[model samples]
Target: MSEGRPRLNTEMVRLGGLIKQAEQALITAKTIALKQFDLTVPQYAALFVLGTTPEASAAQLARACLVTPQTMATVITNLEAKGLVDRSTSPMHRRLRETRLTDTAIPVLEGADRAAVQIEEALAVEFSPEELRSLQELLNRTITALHQLG
Candidate 1:
């Protein structure tokens, strides 16, 4: 159609742009969320994953955070240097370093969580409950379809 030129008005193309733009905005808000703790958004994400998974490898954490292993390594190194997290050889996989949060990180993560919630609440104030539910359902279906495609 139209000499094979790309069209931005297509449903999928518009949906992809919306998702990307939302993610970028969320990342910015999360960065502000963790700024008080002197942590970057990725660092906060890694810490949260480590806190939950306890002794997770950087690669696994990277996959969970949707970042490259190389980028995750740098985030892990930074967390380790700050004494917010520690890494040791995994019992089952000796080569992989298992990482977890330190005692100090819990409080910081809690504060960051609150900040993130505030941002989320502010964003959600404009949407009705039904709209939010519908939006989430559509997003889940889209994600499932993309996963199947991949």
Candidate 2:
């Protein structure tokens, strides 16, 4: 439609297709790993976030996961039911409850980490080290841009 520039439909279409493929690949990997633990994707996400940032509150976890507080509350409740996380009142703020990994959760999180590493290895097998680094850099930039837009 531009006066002189050629339309980039092919490039746009290829990028869209690659994005869709990558999204499905991620979902498939997570789904397979989650089946063993009887955990939903969001539940695993909460566990991983709590593992990385111990003693994070539901609101804080919500912000980390980009979910609403109510949704994160449900995630927290489910994780609690599984005995994977312990909720405690923050010493600094009695009203604010923080979540920490339980003894049982440590092993579960370790297993999840292994499963994720396997997934990454499988994906990395298709690319050279330099290409993998480039891919990661590009993904980081894209994530930053998308978060800024949001």
Which candidate has the highest TM-score of all?
Answer: 1
Question: 102 in model 2: Cα distance from truth in Å?
Answer: 1.3
lDDT score at residue 67, model 1, on the 0-100 scale: 94
Task: Report the C-alpha lDDT of model 1 over 1-150, residue by residue, as the tens digit.
Answer: 697887665455577778899989988987887799899988988887876898898889999988999999999999889889988998897788889899988998888778878988998887899998988899899999999999
Candidate 2, 5: how far from true, in Å? 21
Segments of candidate 1 deviating more than 4 angstroms: 1-13
Clashing pairs in 1: none
| Model 2, span 19-102: residue lDDT tens | 789988887887797778777777778889988899999988998987899999999998899899999999999999999999
TM-score of 2: 0.80
Leading candidate by lDDT = 1
User: What is the lDDT, from 0 to 100, of the residue 6 in candidate 2?
Assistant: 73
Alpha-carbon shift of residue 12 in model 2 (angstroms): 3.4
